[model samples]
Target chain A: MAATTEFELVSPGRLLLSEPVEMVVVPGTDGDFGALPQHAPMLSTVRPGVINIYKGGRVARRLFVAGGFAEVTQERCTVLADEAIDLAEITPAEVQQRLQAADDQVKEARNPEEKAAADRARGLAQALAEAASAAAHAHA
Target chain B: MASLKDLRARISSVKSTRKITSAMKMVAASRLRRAQEAAEAARPYAQRMERMLSNLAASVAGQAGAPPLLAGTGADKVHLLVVMTANRGLCGGFNSSIVRAARHRVLELRAQGKTVKLLCVGRKGRDVLKREFADDIIGTFEEQGSKGITYTEADRVAQDILRRFEAGEFDTCTLVYNRFRSAISQIVTLQQVVPFLPSPAGNDNQGAHGGHEAEAHALYEYEPSEEAILADLLPKCVGIQVYRGLLENYASEQGARMTAMDNATRNAGEMIKKLTLTYNRTRQAQITKELIEIISGAEAL
Candidate 1:
């Protein structure tokens, strides 16, 4: 529909994805929101969660994005994410490993600051793991 | 008088120095490319931030409910000057130029009877400011192995400044740096961090291919009220600003260093050429003198 509204997603080190996906979902800090062609201009913080993009008529091109920002202008929705991963490339095992490591970090934290940081890592890792699994199940 | 051998040695030394300077110039040039790319990459973020900030500023000023970052501390008694310079020397006047600008501002502010505290980011800037305002500098921030200046680094610095601001250490803040214009030119810049006021005429100076009304009075909706959002945004804004400054400084440093080294290499080459000519002349004169002396002695005998 409407040639899959053109949108560009960029991250540091390199330009990750640039395609006219049908609908791109963003995990804003407030909540997860999806955008199509001709969306309203909005700026919001992004939470650490899965950014499920529906390329090819709302049924393809899924991705998992870490926390950062999602700014939507007239025709372009830019995701300034800290980290983004193509669900196709993200193995569930990797997330589980990170989750385990984060769990250990939180458990062994000696100070309040370290504990808080580790807690954040743990929360982020758990969310990532869940998102990755969900993507795998939905695709299967 | 120096002998021909000494001239030859001096020529060789100058030639070696030229090689070193030329190598340094190439290194600086390559580094400059990456630094400039980073600076370019950071521009969009800076623009968006400034846009959001200006919009928020308007909202804050209108309701008299703006955060401390936008509304300011309502006091102009104390000032903080955060000066950023390069770490190493041989960058020509890049470091000195920024220090000079900061010194001028410090003098002007001091004359107005304002209490000021200085914060130096780079080693060169710190060394220069410490000479006069040694006791005033509360912090010197330049760690080599920190994996470049990150958002966290900026946050920490901002936290220190804000902590001091809250504690009444300083009521005002200013940052001095060099803005990279081109490979050969960098303009010394001074920006006010606190009492954030977006230039009213900023839109008037926009590029020919842009909008005005949208830019002049754009509005921002707060998911959790303006104040709360501002509370979170202020510190992040500080971090972003510092990060931008660091990036800009990185590019400017490499640019200045490259130009400086290029000039040095050229000067060294000139000196070597003159030395070599003098060495050849001295050797030729020595040979002629020996030949004439031998002829005279033979004639006398």
Candidate 2:
């Protein structure tokens, strides 16, 4: 039997998932990182990407977070996401619409701060679109 | 002293009132669960925000010329009170308690020769505060009988307050709202929001109330400049705190309504029982009088 690590995912709306998993991959602001049992304590700001939970060396669940903060301890990894959703529920059409809207926002921005925010939004939307397409490819 | 018809009418009225109160109690009880869940679900985010702020605040605590929102204007002459209460009135003393606390704070500030400005979130508080502090009220926000509270509302309120604060309208800001303790109890809490104070001990909220010792000791390296992060996080912090307040107030309102309606139902039942007894006694007396009248008429014949 493989050692398991406790993983907890929380959004502002609710605690989405909490369970013991074989491993978890986090999309940190710096880069992607993997956590398993007895991982060192660390804290990182999460970027907008998909968080994969693994069991028996296979992916068990995939959740997309807009952005948030992640805290990893020796025994547990907790992610506090701004907004979260199941990858299975994301439709390609919705992602495309979000990407278009974000791109429009970028063009409409008048100030540097506004442009920065809009750019971040556009980047996330693109990432989401890519993730959706990748999932479709896997299904096909 | 009332007539038989009146007694009978009173009994029926009391019975109907009991039914209504019981129905309200059931509704409140069901609503309380969702409200409580919303509040609890918000706890992790709120606590995380608080912890992150505390970390940043500790770093910038004594730095000269800190952000106005954090260090304040260093003037205590003007105070703004963000008073929150429920829109509806049947929730026992929930609204009254919040108003009373705000009233007390306003009076205290006045005693100290300070100017107090009121920003009421719900109609109940505005209604009560307007009586004595009509000129002090700066703005009012009402829920419009919404079935559920939302983060969008809180964000709108936060933006308004931020604009006001940036305009230098007030030197300090305090949030007054009911903290839901349980289905039967709510504690009216006065928390200083605008010169952000990290609550020294215990979770300011119930769901994520404490055990943050690890984060407190761990030093963090900021990816971006601390100032940039604070500038972005501070405004959002205000919104998060306000959202938390709204959730707490909603839960408290439902909890209070449930308890109040339960009591009202019980009282109505008691009144119905008393009215029914009087009604029965009156009917028996009227029957006895008729019997006596019949016996007397027979004797006379």
Candidate 3:
């Protein structure tokens, strides 16, 4: 078996990444899962969390994806995210600001559906902010 | 014949008209560049969605418990026509061609003893369709003030369609729009949006993987049931399709306008040339007539 699997990340507007990697950790809706070379074909809906790509037995890149889907074949893993951003690009201040906005949205929501959506937004923002904080602490 | 002053005034008017058309052509050309980029950018997402759906659909085809969006409602007595055209006119035949195609579809449905509902997406389309199918016109949308088409707009339209479908308003839905080919050509297209008609063969990924249908069918396994995944993806697919159509329509409108304005500018230039010739000839005639009379007077004296 090849030591690497073809991994691709696609958003609505553009294709962000397509390459071969040693391992990829996807934030599946059920839970996080790792895919390596020659994995079984499976499809899972993604959640809003960080995806870690490994190469040479170390973490090479990290990306945060807003909910989408992932399709895995034995040789390929394709992630179709609604939105994606490099973890290095987001600042803690921006994450805090987004979390505050999501909180405001939840409070101002008038209907149950609106409130649910705002709550989901808040949860995602909170998770993202926590991830950022954890990464910052690890560096510090 | 008209007076010299009138000829000169007509020439000036034609010259101004030519200027306006030339300016419009430039504007459309610039807008077409942006619209074309937007259309091209949207294609990858739409195509990928189609691939994902095809993968899911290939498994569910001929199954008894398929989603309504794929398996259809099992009836085609009522049809909804979502006609898309530019809100503004002056683009030679862009709007007319779409409306004409829509009208033909409506006529055919009527002939087949089917009920047809018209959901017009732009003012020009509504204006043309309501003249004949006022009662059949169900909804109308105008995007005049919006700077550009957005995914949110497409989602809203798709949501409305889904609501109507759930209400049992229509059994099938089709979209009519002019597919932008180039600045000089657009082809009117009629596509089935609701209860998607899938062409299993000739997909990009299938070719890329070099796998036949049977092998693809055997390879993949769904995490949640295929029905659950399809239920989520189908609405999203509808939104993607609508978004693509709007983008294509925007590009087509700009292309048509550019071509139309180019033709108008040229025609206006020709008219100005003809008018200038008449103006010059009339002025020469008046001068010669006056000179002849003066000469005759001197001769008589």
Candidate 4:
């Protein structure tokens, strides 16, 4: 049996998942990093992307996180996501609609602060769209 | 004495009032359970966030380049009071108690020669505080989390506050809200959120395991330096604090409403009982008077 690290995925609304996993890859602000058992403690900001959870030597599940933070310790890896969605559950149409709304927001933004927020939203939407397409391809 | 018809009307009115109050009580009870569950579910994230923040804060404390959100503006002249209350009015003294506490703080700050500004989160607080502090009110947010309190709603408020802070609007920020204790009791709490006061060591949930956690924290590495992460986390901390306050306020509102409706229902039941007794007594007296009249008429015959 492979050594597993406890993985916890939490959102502001609820605790989404808590269990032992062989490996987990998080999309950090700098880059994607995988945490395995006995990993050194590290803290980083999560980017808007997909997090892949590995179990039994294969990818078991994928979750899309908008943005938040992640903390990795030796025994556990916890990701506090601002928003999370199952990659399998999101449809292409929904992703497209979100991207369109984000684009509109970006165009209508008046000030730098508004523009920055809109840009962040646009980035998240774009990421979601990419993740959705990738998931569809993988499934097909 | 009232007529039998009036007594009957009064009894029926009381009966209807009882029914309405009982219905409200049931509704509030169900809502309270849901609100409680929401609050409970959000605890772990909040706790972990706070724990990690405090750990990072401890490492960065007393540094020259600490973020203002954690280091503060180095002054306490101006204060921002974020009063959180329910939008509706039927929740007993829940809103008033929070408002009263805020008002008291305002007066105290005034006495201390400190400038106070009001940022009300709910409609009821604004309505109550407007009479005296109309000029002091910077903003009022109504219909927030009308369906249920969500993080996005809280983030919006936090962003507004953060913007104001960036513009040098206030030096300190305090949140006044009702902390849910139980279904019948809600304690008015005044929590200072700004300047990021870490929770006391003794109050940590990881009391027994603190040594182990602290050892791990000492050896932990930061991705973009502690200062950068702290800068990012502080604003999020404000959002999380607001989220926590909103959630607690919501649960407290439901609990308070449940208790208040329960009391109203009981009072109405008592009123109905008294009205029924009065109606019966009045009917019997009228029957006796009619009987006496009939007996007198028969004797005359």
Candidate 5:
């Protein structure tokens, strides 16, 4: 049997997930990185994307995180996400709504800071929409 | 000396007040439970964030180019007090205690020849402080956690503070709020968020076991370099600190409200008891007077 590492997904609201997993893939700001047992300790920022959790050599669950930080140790990987949601629970309509709102925000932003924030939101919303569609295709 | 009808009215009024207070107590009890759970659930994230940041801060400490958030602006001329209190007034002494502590800090800082700027998080704090320190108050936030304390709200406040810091607004920032001890007791706590100060307990333990932990930390590899991570994490640390303060203050508010309402309910019960007793006594006296008058009238006939 392969070694399992403890994975914890924490949001500010609560601890979303805490369990032993065979592997986990995090979408870091630099790139996607996978953490397995005995991985070297590393800290990186997480971008808004899907985090794939593996169990028994198969992707067991997928979660969407807005953005935050990830700290990887040899035995455990803790992800402090600003927001996290189970991809399975997201509806297409919700994604569309978010995209629309983000688009409107981008158009209505009056200052540089507001524009930057709105751009980030739009990027996140776009990513979420794509992820939702991809998940839909995978399920189909 | 009161009429029987007046005593009856007073007794009923007290009874209704008791009912309202008891209801408020129950509501606060339930809300307190939820707030306590939320605070508990957020502990792990905040703790881990602190641990990681402290590790990074330890590595980056004393560096010439350290982030200003960690190393501070190298001057204590200006201070910002982020006073967190409840918006509502039902809580007994919760808001007042926090405001009092903040006011004391403001006075102390001013006495030391430091400029003090106030950033109030809740309306109650702003309302109280505005009377005396109206000119010093820079910003006021209200109803940020009306539904429940959220990270986004804290992040907004943190971003505002960061912007102010970037503009050279304040040298030091302190967060003042109530630390929930129990449903009956909450202690007013003042925590320095800017120029990040590690908790004294963590500092002492780290000093005692510095050697091995330092070795362990040295093994961890940084992705985009230590400085970048520290810069990113420092602002987050501020946000998390504010988030924690808000959460703790919220739980304390609920706990305080629960206790206050419990006391109010008890006081109302006592008043109702007294009023009911007076009502009974007055009715009995009125009946006795009527009986004596009827008996005397019969004797005259």
Candidate 6:
């Protein structure tokens, strides 16, 4: 049996990634987890974070998923992102602005629901910012 | 018989018209190709979203406390028509088809003792409908020259719709647009957005992946409770659905226009050929008669 599994990441604008990857780590609603081939079927709401794609006994690539859902079959994983960016295309500075905007919305949010959504946006933005900064100095 | 100058003018005019239609056809064809690709790419995301929504919505079908969007307003006294069309025109009957469908439906609703309101999302639709249904139009929105319509724009439209719903402005809502069927054929579509209809029963009990649809069904305990979940999800659903509908309509318009222009161009070419043939025959006859007159005059002298 082959040790690797296939994963596809897509959005309305573009299909970001599709290939055989060793492992795919995603941020599940309950918590973050890593997935491999032949995994049990699962569906989860994914927040913004770096999706670490492991291949060839090493971490091969990283993707920043803004907000989306993940569907896992027995042998493949599909991530439908509302918005996603290649890690290389993103910058810490860009996400910092997003974080600031989200924070401002938090202050202006009138009700609890609005505030909660705004809060989620802020958390996701901050997470993206942190990931961008950490990976900024890591050449390739 | 028509004068020689008249025929010459007619020929030139037809030629110019042919050129314009031909150019338009080329432009439409290029735009249509792009729109078609985009629409094709969007299919997967749309289907997946619907599948997820259906799964989630099915779970709460018989259960109480479903959101208003899924649960519906529980009445049909008032109706809102969300008319979607192109912001621009010159695509022959593309814009008119949607407006025509909306007009027919609105008239039917009025006759049935129902209240109908118009909420036009595109400039072309508003321009057409306002001539007669001026009072019925509540709001008009057009995002011309934008890179493309955004979810944020969709959200804004949904927010407005939701506000009206809260005030009980509409009990049943319908969306009017054109469905992209093919390059040659585009079908005008009218979809009911509210008053959730229970899907056909007994089609699939098996999950998408599993052998049994029943096994694939997901069970979730709502975080804040089903009522709250519905309240939140329903509004978002409205936005997403509208956003999708807008994109679909946009693509459809371009396709329809492209096809229509192509036909026009071919028709113009055929007409120009016919006109040129007539012009040539008339010129030959005039020349022949003049030569006979000159020969007879010389013989008499």
The list of candidate 4 runs beyond 4 A from truth reads: A100-116, B199-212
For candidate 4, the docking band is: medium
Deviating ranges (above 4 Å) for candidate 1: A1-22, A36-43, A59-63, A71-110, B146-149, B199-209, B212-220
TM-score of each: 0.87, 0.85, 0.91, 0.92, 0.91, 0.81
In candidate 6, list every pair of residues with a backbone clash. Answer: B205-B213, B205-B214, B206-B212, B206-B213, B207-B212, B207-B213
- lDDT score for residue B96 of model 2: 97
The residue-by-residue lDDT of candidate 4 on A1-140, one tens digit each, is 89999899998889899999999999998899999999998889888999999999998999999988898888889999999999988888898999999999999999998899999999999999999899888888
The CA lDDT of each predicted structure is: 0.75, 0.84, 0.84, 0.88, 0.87, 0.74
Output the number of the DockQ-best candidate: 4
User: Which residue pairs does candidate 3 place in steric collision?
Assistant: none
Scored against the true structure, residue A96 in model 4 reaches a CA lDDT of 91
Candidate 3 has what TM-score?
Answer: 0.91
What tens digits encode model 1's per-residue C-alpha lDDT throughout B126-213?
Answer: 9988999998898988763333445566666777777777777877788788878777899887777776754322233336315533
Query: At residue B134, what lDDT does model 1 achieve?
Result: 94
Please give the ranking of all candidate structures by DockQ, highest first, separated by commas: 4, 5, 3, 2, 1, 6
Residue B27's C-alpha lDDT in candidate 6?
74
Report residue A122 deviation for candidate 5 (angstroms). 1.4
Return the DockQ of model 4: 0.66
- Specify the CAPRI tier of model 6: acceptable
| DockQ score of each predicted structure, in the order shown | 0.28, 0.35, 0.55, 0.66, 0.61, 0.26
lDDT of 6 at B179: 74
Instruction: Give stretches of model 3 more than 4 Å off.
Output: A100-104, A111-113, A134-140, B199-215
Deviation (Å) of A138 in candidate 6: 6.1
Candidates ranked by TM-score, best first?
A: 4, 5, 3, 1, 2, 6
Q: On a 0 to 100 scale, what is the lDDT of residue B165 in model 2?
A: 93
Over A4-23, each residue of candidate 5 has an lDDT whose tens digit, in order, gives: 99899998888899999999
Q: Encode model 5's per-residue lDDT on B1-301: one tens digit a residue.
A: 9988888788888888889888989998998999999887877677768777876777777889998999999998999999998888989999999998999999999999999999999889899999999999999888664578887888888999999999999999999988877899998888898999874322422443354353346566777678777878889889988888888889999999999999999998888888878888888888999999999999999
- Predicted candidate 1 versus true structure: per-residue lDDT over A1-140, tens digit per residue: 45465565654323467667778878776667887776765666777877766765556776676676565655556675656777788787888889999999999999998899899889888888888888889888
What's the lDDT for candidate 6? 0.74
